[model samples]
Target: MLNRFLLPALAATLLTTACTEPPKTVAALPILGERDVRPRADGGPADTVYAAVPAFRLTDQAGQPVSNQTFAGRAYVTDFFFATCPGICPKMQSELLKVYKKFPTDPRISFLSITIDPDHDSTAVLRDYAQRLGIGDASRWHFASLGDRAKSFELANHLLTGVVPDSLAPGGLAHNGTLALVDDRGYIRGAYDGLNAGQVAALQRDIPVLLAEIDGRKKGVAKK
Candidate 1:
């Protein structure tokens, strides 16, 4: 009869609808680097801890000592730039400002702009630069110095982003034009080209995803 045929078709449509629903958002961001690996006691395979930015101490624009601990429970965007750069640094900052404006006053997020030219960008210089940029909130944004030239280069080239001294370069130093997104746990979640509007927008999108992932984990633990 028509009732029997219609019932089966309705069931089929319902099944199809159930199957087509989008899956839940899962945070599966790949951990960068393979060095933080260890062998399992059961001898199955080595486990990777996922590379994390090592602890560092630096002086912020306010002449205050800040370290990795400063961002212990906050997600942050980081980039390397000197105050007087005549090239892409300005563009990078302009893009980063968009991200900042999007999350302004959100204590869960912060920004770090570390200077590669620390010798010339002293605390006073950084403070002045920050002021000019309208960065009135020191807690949310920091312009810092690594203090040591070799350490600065090491951090720029190895830890956060790429940087190299070049006499022929526009700013006396060549550096990556990307911004690094670090999760609350100190792991680098993602990197976006700070000079590209599209990539910067992607960075903004990923920030909430990372924050949601952290929130989900916390709720899971609480339910246990």
Candidate 2:
């Protein structure tokens, strides 16, 4: 009788304790001081992300209207350059040409090249430039205009805020070769120094990371 009571009491105590005590939580891993391989917070990233493309109406080389909505649900890599740029621009274009070769024109992505010299780079000029870079492939690449130098300079300062005076020449156009990596939502996620090989390599690695992040966000896998 005593042994039977002891067994029942022990089982009852365990049941009560389990019900009353809290469960343990596993700890997450850390990475280089950031939160392990997870996506950074909104504005937590070096570049902030916009939910959608900004409201701006522009035209492509084809004279087709390329508005903000044109980039919806699509990621793109873009930089500013004039067709007759004397320095840096050629190298940047070459680097981007490589990037275009790497990723086919998937609907998920596009390559945008906005001419800083839109006045000189008319539709005919841009059309010829596109021809030089492999025009047959229409899926993911574009060369467009951002209007006059005033509008172009304003966007560089107001929107990009990433330009400087050029010293290589007295009155030559001053600029940076940094390529903005925009997400499908038209938010800038990251940037790359398109003129440098090492930076291009880093961009290559980060490109996939960004694409994956985009996919996760769409699937609701990204954490808030």
Residue pairs with backbone atoms closer than 3 Å in model 2 (clashes): none
lDDT of 2 by residue, 84-185 (tens): 888788899999888877777556778888777778888778888888877654336778887777777655543343555466642367888877777766
The clash count of every prediction, one per candidate, is 0, 0
Q: Which portions of model 2 show Cα errors greater than 4 Å?
A: 1-53, 158-171, 221-224
* C-alpha TM-scores of all predictions: 0.88, 0.70
lDDT per residue (tens digit) for residues 126-193 in model 1? 99999999899777899999899879877765455778889999978888886988887888888888
Full-model lDDT for every candidate: 0.85, 0.70
Clashes of 2: 0
- Where in model 1 is the C-alpha error above 4 Å? 1-21, 221-224
| lDDT, residue 223, candidate 1 | 100
List pairs with backbone clashes in candidate 1: none
lDDT of 2: 0.70
